[model samples]
Target: MPDEHDQDEEPELELTSALVPFFVITNGRALPSDQQYERTALVTALKGTSAAARTLSPEAQAIVDLVAHGFLSVAEVAGHTHLPLGIVRILLAQLEESGLVLVRKPVPRAEPTDRELLGDVLAGLKSKFGA
Candidate 1:
């Protein structure tokens, strides 16, 4: 027998049926066997976003709403929506195809260093403070 607390927990979302139509509609055919989307890619809603939002599925709409606030990575969307990462990727690809969302690769950040670019910070600090 399951614990009472277990019964109170929300049911897990099922995507197989719910996402099938989205995949078909977006692809204009069956789901692809192999589609690749970068998990770290950032998504942003396009301009005139309200009209575009109206054309999306409820799931896709939710994703658009989240993206409108700010750019969000693919993994972030999956986490926020509680959808599987693969589903989010497919949905994002559809949105991207329609120009409703813009997907961008995350910019690589420069590594931090202890060395200063111009000169030693201590020399400048000593000169300014006169200690």
Candidate 2:
């Protein structure tokens, strides 16, 4: 039987090995030239659907699998993959270039005017504390 120390060390080793590919993909690489993929942009995999994904590098394949369930923001992808934001952006740009992933820009939310916000706040206060 494996000793307790051996069992504990196995998972750590596995994790380090898993991160190796990401390091290889990103190391010594410049940020992708395209600046369109904002951190909040949503990314979805076209994996089986996009013929290009068949030739993806291991790092890109890992990202495709993560997005297989649903779309995720670029920042979320970086966080989940344990890659730096710049590296994730570079990977995403490459995948997008090959049509393996769809990057949707985040919708810009309109800020409410101060007058409109104050009106709503006043209504809420009146409802709770009486006019």
Candidate 3:
């Protein structure tokens, strides 16, 4: 038989956080006005822009806060906030429009076959190997 105390006790209630959908967070917007914020693009908060951030949603504000101190790549921001890349791009565009942040595209990669550079490398290798 169960104890009298056990029978009188109520089951404990478990609390859980509500799940918010991506559309809700992004206000049903699919893409940003421009495609400037690629995954590797660097972003930083504009100085003295905290006042403007007050009007942003929680997710947008989080992005501004993350970049306030320094620069962070779009991919880094997504990873840090656990937000999807597409969502991050949208939020960043909004922040940039509000003058809350600055975005810098990554430097373009060098051409794979710079004739002069490759020739120099070949000459160095031939001299080193006596070929």
TM-score of each: 0.56, 0.59, 0.69
RMSD in angstroms, all models? Answer: 11.0, 9.8, 7.9
Deviation of model 1 at 42, angstroms:
0.9
Error of 2 at 77 (Å): 0.4
Give one digit per residue, the lDDT tens place, for model 3 in 7-74: 54685444565478877888887686445788889999999987877888999989999999999999
Model 1 clash count equals: 0
Candidate 2 similarity to native, TM-score:
0.59
Q: What is the lDDT of residue 119 in candidate 2?
A: 91
Expressed as tens digits, the lDDT of each residue in 4-114 for candidate 2 is: 667654464445355356457865556875457788999998757546566667677889888987999999998998888888888888778777788998997797679
Rank ordering of all candidates by lDDT, starting from the highest: 3, 2, 1
17-124 per-residue lDDT for model 1 (tens digits): 653554553445333223245778788888787885786777889998999867998889989988777778878877877888898876667878667744677788
Task: Report the C-alpha displacement of residue 111, candidate 1, in angstroms.
Answer: 15
Q: In model 1, which residue pairs have backbone atoms overlapping below 3 Å?
A: none
Query: Clashing pairs in model 3?
Result: none
lDDT of candidate 1 at residue 32, scale 0 to 100: 26
lDDT of each: 0.75, 0.79, 0.86
Shift of residue 84 alpha carbon in model 2, Å:
0.4
